[model samples]
Target chain A: MTTTEKIRGLILKVAKGKLSQEALKPEARLSEELGLDSLAQSELLVLAEDSFGIKFTHDEVWTVATIGQMVEVIDSRLAAK
Target chain B: MRQSAGILGTGACLPEQVLTNLELAERFGVTPDWIFERTGIVQRHIAAPEQACSDLAIAAARQAMENAATAPEEIGMVIVATITGDYTTPATAAIVQGVLGIPAVACFDLSAACSGFVYGMIVGSHAISCGFCNKVLVVGSEVLSRFTNQTDRDSAILFGDGAGAVVLGGVPEGYGLLATDAGTCGTEYQAIIIPAGGSRLPPSAETIAAHLHYSHMDGNQVFMFAMRVLGNSTLRTIEKAGLSLDDISLIIPHQANRRIIEAAAGRMELPLSKIVINLEQIGNTSSASIPIALHGVLTDGRIRHGDRLVLTGFGGGVSWGSALIRWHSPGSDQIHKKEKNDDNN
Candidate 1:
């Protein structure tokens, strides 16, 4: 799956029944649109680490605010690896 | 010529499930001894899945009434001190009163965190003295196990599910509740709290996934605060009671941790023997701690008639309180009868 597709899937999985594909667009505001809070945001980071098999630091979690930015970061990290 | 309010009875109830430090250590990858050395907690009670905070409160309140030979109807007021109420709106005290069939009493809940029971006593005593009520039921109950994060080792080992209660009634001149002091500092609210689930951050799927409903704490900061406040508050209350620390026959402080309790005792220059310590089995039952310790002390026959005692507590909301009281009808082996035989008869 593409990085964006993977990030979207992770958000939906962690949120379980809350978030779906239609609601979690790449350009959408995760907090405003999908209603993710800090705790949920942390859970997304954990899910991303598991899905992409890359560890992200707390500071890195702060830098990636949206699904699109997170995809870019993950793709670059995977590319580097 | 201050009217006194003596503790007529005391009782405590712990949930059936007992969680030992060893069990918790295996889950957290820490040594059992490490948990004991740091927190002095050996085991803690865990509520049944279906149980709520009011359930424990009812149990404790019932026992207190039974011990005092007081009927449910005689209880003019009920005060429940808790942070983990069954609902956010209706006071847990009301539910407890309903369950106990004490419909005539006015009931409410106080949220001074762990210091609640002492605060409740202060409020109850004042109401009694002011002729607002005669018999008051003060209970501290918590189902902290329900709000605890299983994965958070720092907090998981330090809290338990339980309730403690005391019945306070008006007594003759100079014999019941002498003096009490209560205070709070909202600035330290962040030191221990449930971050979400309030108006500030209402619960959502996000909150659930993040476990925002769970309890959180800055242990080091709270420890420092507890050590400082516990002793300071006790001394302040003692001074206000027009007595010296030496006049206190027994000191009952919040059972947050052994280290904090011992440090406070040391600072007060009170010997370990004079302080009630039960954290080894109960952990920190928050507001329930003081009354539980009081019940234990009474049951053990440590307190005597006319013995002066100091009760103090410090906990979340940065709340703290202390009260000096003289034991009445102490050392009497009046077996607390649970059955409601009319005291008039």
Candidate 2:
């Protein structure tokens, strides 16, 4: 699968039971649109790191708010690797 | 080979006053749902102004000894695990022993933050195994409310005041403690800490003015540490016991956060149904959490004879621990039948 699809998969995993797939558009805000609270967002970050073999700095974690932003960060990290 | 030690009985004492999420949210200018969504805590028990850590410890210890059918004179050692002692000098265990009239035996305090109880279990069990004591009382009591910075939402919403105790004594062979795993990441001790009041940063007029006595934590750091350690430490202890996750009937984890527990359970490929989580009603009681949860399940009849359990915790030391136990009911003839068969063979 593509990097976007892979990251979306991780979000779905974190959002399981609470979110629907239709709500996960590229522009979806993790907290507002997708209902990812602080704890859930942290879980998603850890899951994405393990799944994509990438680490996010503290500043990056706070800045990435949308699903599209998370995808971008993961793709860039993968490129750097 | 050393003698096996097991918990004879358990008890817990939560303060009478309750702090609901709504009340706390008002202080931080956030909604109650906001706190619950982030921490999964509905309310926490707060100690009264006149109450101290020793008061709760004494009450819980009395109930534990009563449940164990043990007289005060029967207990040979008392270990109070806490970072919130009544005084910085005198150990809270000493006060508990005196109040309960538990004889002038070995009494001391243990400070591993949230991992205190499991560490106490290891020490108490070893004492029995070495035949140094016939009975040991282990208590985890904390008055975090006293140290909580009400202005800081992060630490204020997550902590509560309470105590839990267990009576430890010899158990039949092949029963009680099976294996244990404990370790510390000293380099990451700052993940959760109180910056002052200790000798390293002794209390002073400057420290008091700066609000240094209150608990401080890096939420993300502790979250990451807990997620990585809780499941791995439990797995290691289970393996050390010559068993697997399937063999454990229940898992009592430190009640830090629901999301942490869920993530740990996910890592183990275990169902949430098998874990005991009580933080929603009591919030995080630190070292008191495990025994409080353990006591709840036992009282509710969720634990049964011969059932294997895993008790695990992670905390401020960046420390982590897990203990594997095969239950053998105290004051009863119900020994593990499978082990009896092995003994016969």
Candidate 3:
């Protein structure tokens, strides 16, 4: 699967079926639009790290505000591998 | 294996006042469901204005000693684990030692935040193994309410005041503390902190006005750190004890957040019933959480002789700790003999 698809899948897992696929636009804010609170956002980041076999530095973890931003972070880590 | 230090008795003291979710939700202009959904807390016990951390600690220590059937003269050390000590200079443990008339061989305070009790267990247990003390009293007491920003809804609902204590003494080699683990990620110390009242930011009028003394936590950071550490730390200690998860009867974790505990338990593939959670009525009592929960389960008869338990916690120093203990309550030998005789009949 594409990195975006994979990241979306992890987000849904964090969401626990609360956010539908269509609502997961690239620009969708993890906290605001997707309704993932700070705790859930952290969970999503960790899940993404595990799912993609990648790690986000402390700085990178806080920088991702939206689904598209998270995808970019994951892609860069995957590329570095 | 040689004899090991184990808890002889456990006791806890929560203040009489209750802070229900409804009261806090109304004060914060939110619905009770909003608070409950986020924290899984129905109510928490709050200390009266007259009560201090040391008071709670003394009460709990007294009960622990009494339950252990130990005289004050027998306790060689007093260790109170708390961040909210009554005074800044003297240790709360010293106060507890004095009040309990423990004739202190040694008295000190340990501050590892919520992991304090587990750290105390490790320290107190080692003191016994190395012949430093005969019996050690480890008490975790906190008045987080004093350090909490009542107007700050996020933190206000998450903390409560309470104390719990355990008397530690040698038990049969295979029936006490098996193994323990503790570590700190100092880089994340900022995640949970009281920004002021320390030498770094001494309390000034400006600091007081800014509420810098109140505890502030990065909820996201703590949640992430706890989820990553809690279950894994327990498993690591279990491994160190030369045991597997199957041998653990219950996992007593720090009562920080219900969601964090649930998620960590999920990662370990451990059922919730195998975990002790007393947060609904206690909220997060910081260092006092694990011991308080331990006392709760023990009082409810949930723990029995020979039941192995893994006590784990993560907290402010960005620290985490776990201790593997085989429950060997006082008078367990008699209980065992009675059970055996009944079985024969």
Model 2 — interface RMS deviation? 1.7
| DockQ of predicted candidate 3 | 0.62
In angstroms, how far off is B55's CA in candidate 3?
0.7
Better of 2 and 3 by TM-score: 3
> Where is model 1 more than 4 Å wrong at Cα?
A1-81, B330-345
Off by over 4 Å in 2: A17-35, A53-81, B332-345
Query: What is each candidate's DockQ, to 2 decimals?
Result: 0.01, 0.45, 0.62
- The CAPRI classification for model 3 reads as medium
Which residue pairs show backbone clashes in model 2?
Answer: none
Query: Model 3: how far is B53 from its true place, Å?
Result: 0.7
| Chain A TM per prediction | 0.88, 0.93, 0.92
lDDT of 3 by residue, A1-81 (tens): 998998888888778889899999999988888898877788777667667777678788778999889888777777788
Model 1: lDDT of residue A10? 71
* Arranged by TM-score, best first: 3, 2, 1
Each model's TM-score, in the order given? 0.77, 0.90, 0.94
**Tens digits of lDDT, candidate 1, B1-345:** 445677888888999999999999999998999888768899999999999999999999888888888888889999999999999979998899888989667899999998899989999998888888888999999999888998899889899999999999877787888888889989878989898999999999999899999998866557656766887788888888889867888999999988678655654567888788999999999999999999988876677778899899998988899989887872223422211132434
- In candidate 1, position A41 carries an lDDT of 62
lDDT digits (tens) for residues A1-81 of candidate 2: 987788777888888777767888999999998988777788888778778877788789789999899999888888888
In candidate 2 chain B, what residue range of length 10 has the lowest lDDT sum?
B332-341
Q: Count the backbone clashes (under 3 Å) in each candidate.
A: 3, 0, 0
